[model samples]
Target: MSENIQKKIEDLREELHQHNYNYYTLDEPTISDFEFDLKLKELQELEKNHPEFYDSNSPTLRVGGEITKNFPTVQHQFRMYSLDNSYDFNDLEDWEKRVQKALNKPVEFVAELKYDGASISILYENGKLKEAVTRGDGFQGDEITPNVKTVSEIPMQLHGDFPDRFFIRGEIYLTRKNFDKINKRREEEGLDPFMNPRNTASGSLKIQDSAEVRKRGLSAVLYQYISSEFPAKTHWELLQKAKSWGFHISEQAKLCKTLDEVKAFITHWDTARHQLGFDIDGIVIKVNDLSQQRSLGYTAKSPRWAMAYKFKAEKVETELEKVTYQVGRTGAITPVANLKPVLLAGTVVKRASLHNEDIIKKLGLHEHDFVFVEKGGEIIPKIVGVNLDKRNPENPEIQYIKTCPECGTELVKIEDQAIHFCPNELHCPPQVVGRMIHYVSRKALNIENLGQETIEQLYREKLVENPADFYALKKEQLLPLERMAEKSAQNIISGIEKSKEIPFEKVLYGIGIKHVGETVAKKLAKNFESIDE
Candidate 1:
């Protein structure tokens, strides 16, 4: 009787995995929703009764109940290099010339959509999903296997011929329909809606509850196949093989035999990208021959063979209600344009960087002027120009502020510098808080528990002023603050204590000097034996 039950469980798991592959990866569902749910329910009951037949990759695990407090960082077996970008056809021609010169031969190219989503690397062993990691700093990333497993598009078990062990890199994204649905629910519940699909998808992978990740309705599309011995000779063939093995490879990927064909592919997609269900910022072009790619080699940062062609940024016009200033850590005052909320690209734009006083003057910005807003590189919002025809005639010309907004001190503009500086570096609230925040940043001391809010609280209560003051903090002092519990307060102290073991270069960078950046700090550390030197 037990043997019969075990066989039934195994059969159900296989059947459900096939149904998932058919629905998500193939885009062709063999079973109806009602029928699939009935089978899933049956499997859940069987699995619940027989603990001995538990399988980690079983389709039942798709509902996701695992809670991960901390995602452990793991090094990639192969370095995940970023692609060099090409904004125009001229740039692509130059890149092609360089590649041809290096290889000394003709090469076919593979053109794939540059999906604007979080990059992920997943490992498979013996046709079963093993681990999934994010693309962090190229060398290492956080392991979020349980959260990734909840994505139905990623198969737990391979169907066809598969490698014994290998890693496949791809993108994890949320569809446009789901993104709207999520934001609609959030708006109804009186909560702040997500800014964009890319950020929302990335944030979902780090959520503590796997069940919550499933609710986010995430999807995956595998593109690149990595292994010690590739199954195919060309990049295009490898993608085809991956698709056959139950991976959700993009059907839109094309192979171009010449530069003209590649250009045509870009032209077609440049307009058609808006029609896609998910967001894509550009097109990724790569040399098809695997051997030629190996011979071309790579630069320090990115592969020499692959290049990304970014689309022109979408621009929109809105009313510039007013201009505000922000104080940086170095006392530089940056002008910001507060605009009437307008939708640019996929996200809503409420404010844009005016950069400095020079930019405001160049735009001839005035009170209640209509201005053009666009994402600089599909990333940061910037005011490009003013719609002068729509400008109000009676409005006053925008003037640069002479006094520091926070400290009420006279501002100074250095010769040859476009920015106005707040000379009151010592007592300015923003500068002081910015310095402390910079000190505990990831690249510097890497203090985990201490965040921007807690630092502001510490400053408000007069408990700390400088980075050095963090070392002298007591548990009792932190406990008195709002939302500070016994465990959280101890964790903050422990984090500060661990920061003492940071390297000399990081310590130098954390000191918050005006001109000393990470690269300069490393050079200084190499020359000087100690901090005093």
Candidate 2:
């Protein structure tokens, strides 16, 4: 390894993530899509051969950023892990060679559909469902038992003969049919439809309201049999046993005896994936025998015996109508690409993110230009490049702005910062309201019924200015608002009063201090004990 392998990894990680944001989050890509994939390939190869450089938050993870601290965290008895990804057959072949070398024997692999969904860990005690947790950081996750129980497919009580205590890992997903229905309903109700089944499933799994999660129609299919006393020697046997115990294992899972068979399975799914009701991004190939998997062992972040072969993301073309800007809580002004509504990856996207001025300039974009869009991670729609051959000459070239959208103040671009900042944080309406909203967010004050709309209304009415004023709110004052009812006002005030007893970390997080989050707040609370200290 190079002396700067660690630095190489860090630099690659940063470069790849910058591209990912431009591609995925902003719908803008500074590099060609093929070049971007090559970068990911480089990073994955480095991480695979040298596991020590593995970073959990690597762009390769494309890890969900939907975590909220409202739910209690649960530590897993066995560490949950991610699988290494293989973009092509050669990568898969190389992985098998490594596994065979580790065990010094030919290996039979079991192939299963890699569902494009969220992962969950469920525990059973005495053959009864005990707890379910989101796979957070591969060790500790959020306990979402109540919400998980809403998924009708997951049996609350196991029926067949089974272990007294056991664990199961599964991919929680929303079927495409159900996802469309939900989206249609959302669109009819004038709410922005969900982006994809994977995100919808992830967001659903963490909901506090079981009834709402149930309506989301989420389902789970067991992917692994986990426990201190793992019984079956072969993975195939475990799947059959899990299915017999009322756990739904995907019918598409196949037992493969060789790498050729695994490739066949991958090829079969690549074309046939659209036929399946639920979205599947790739195929997972694992050593058939559990003993082989143990011997093959694991890296810091992924299983050595298993690897995921991802299908190429589908691409589409759409028209960019205009560019708009929005301000984040941190005061960074981000450019947004307002596109003529088009359906990609089963969701209608009215707009895609443009990231910043640099990304805008790189694409050489113009208003009303034709651009090609692709779901970069099969999660977010991004513009890889403009369709230059079809560029509209009549439309004007895209121009950058200098003023903050929330407040008409001149924006400041700090040295070494990619984003422009609004210096007028004190009076910017969006920043003020954004801060107030964050203070009462579920991860902070956790004030129930005080949503963004309510906070904005309170600010506009001058009924509340800062977070401290919330506790002092009078029910009489709330009644004068547009549609506030006597009971609603009482509930709001009651919820506000209840927040007074929240932990000191939560209070610190709610304080809206720059660079402070729940984790930082918790650290401060633990060391200081009191604010003065």
Candidate 3:
């Protein structure tokens, strides 16, 4: 009876894996959802009853109940370098010229959609999924193996010929349909809707619950295969091999023999991208020949053989309702345009940055004017231009504020700076709170649990005023604050304690000094032994 059960489990696992590949990778469902679910339920029941027949690569594992308290940081074997960006055909031509000049030969290209999502590096050993990591700083990233395993699009086991040990890098993205579904559920639950699919998908990977990660409906498209042994001679061929191995590859990916063909591919996708259920910000053009890629080599930050042609930012006409001023941590005053809510690039835009007085002047702002708002690089929303035809001549022109809105302090324009600054840096409320927030940020001391809201809450309660006061925080005092649980308070205290071991360079960066960035802080730390110097 036990032998019969083990055979049944193995057969079910293979059949489910094939069905998953067919539905997801091939875009063909061999069975209805109800039938699939029933089969899955039977297998799940059998597996639960017979623990001796457990298989790590079983389809049942995709449901994901594993909990990860902390994801361990692991160094990548091959450094995941970023691609150099090109805005126009001229830039692509220039890149092509440089590549040809270096190689002194004709070259072919592979054009693939640059998916706007979290970058992931997944390692497979002996045809089995071993580890998955994020593209943290190129050199190292957090190991999110359990979270990645939850993604049904990524095959847990290879089917065809593959390298003994290899790493496949790809983008993990949330489909537009799934994103909308999630937002709808969140809205019903009285929670703030996620800003975008890319951000939501990226954040899902870091979630402690593997079950939650599974529910996010994350998908991946493997683009690059890295290994010591060469499986194919060209990039396009590599993608084909990866697809045969049960990895999802983009069907839109095309091989271009010439730069003109590459341009045509980019031009086609620029408009047709809207039809895609997933978000793609641009096109990635790479030299097709593996030997040529290796010969072309890499620059300091990106691959010299490949280039990313970014599509122009999506622009939408919206009514500019009003203008607001914000004070930054450096006391720089920024003008913000409050707009009538308009959807652009899947996200609603209600406000956009005017950048400074110079940008405001360049745009020729007027009250109640219809303006062009675009997401700069598909992330930051900014007002690009004014729709003059729709602008009312009777409306008054918008002017930059002459004083700090937060403190009523007179603002002064610094020499060579475009934006006006509030000279009251020491006493400005925003600057003080911003500085404290910056001190515990990821690049700074990295005190966990000390988020912006918590800092603001502490400031409003009069429990803390500056970064120095964080060290004096007591568990008794924290427990009384809103939403402050005992474990959270203890975690914050522990994080604060751990931050003391951070390097002097990071400490210098955390101090919120004017013009002191991470690199500058590192340089200062190298020059001086202590802060006294």
Best of the candidates, TM-score: 3
Residue 431 of model 1, lDDT score: 88
lDDT of 3 by residue, 340-441 (tens): 999887678899978799998888899999999887543348888888998889999988888889999999997898989998887798888888878887
Top candidate (lDDT)? 1
User: What lDDT tens digits, residue by residue, belong to model 1 across residues 352-435?
Assistant: 988788898998889999998987432348888889899879999999999999999999999998989999988999889888
Considering only N, C-alpha and C atoms within 3 Å, which residue pairs clash in candidate 1? none
| Per-residue alpha-carbon lDDT of candidate 2 for residues 68-168, written as tens digits (9 for 90 to 100) | 34899899889998989989888987887788778888789899999988999999887657888989998899998777766656665565678999889
lDDT (CA) for every model shown? 0.90, 0.80, 0.89
Per-model TM against the reference: 0.67, 0.61, 0.68
Please give the TM-score that candidate 1 achieves against the real structure: 0.67
Q: Pairing residues by index, what is the TM-score of model 3?
A: 0.68
Which regions of candidate 2 deviate over 4 angstroms? Answer: 1-111, 117-220, 224-238, 252-279, 285-308, 378-380, 526-533
RMSD of each: 10.9, 17.7, 10.1
Candidate 1: Cα lDDT at 3: 99
| lDDT of residue 212 for candidate 1 | 89
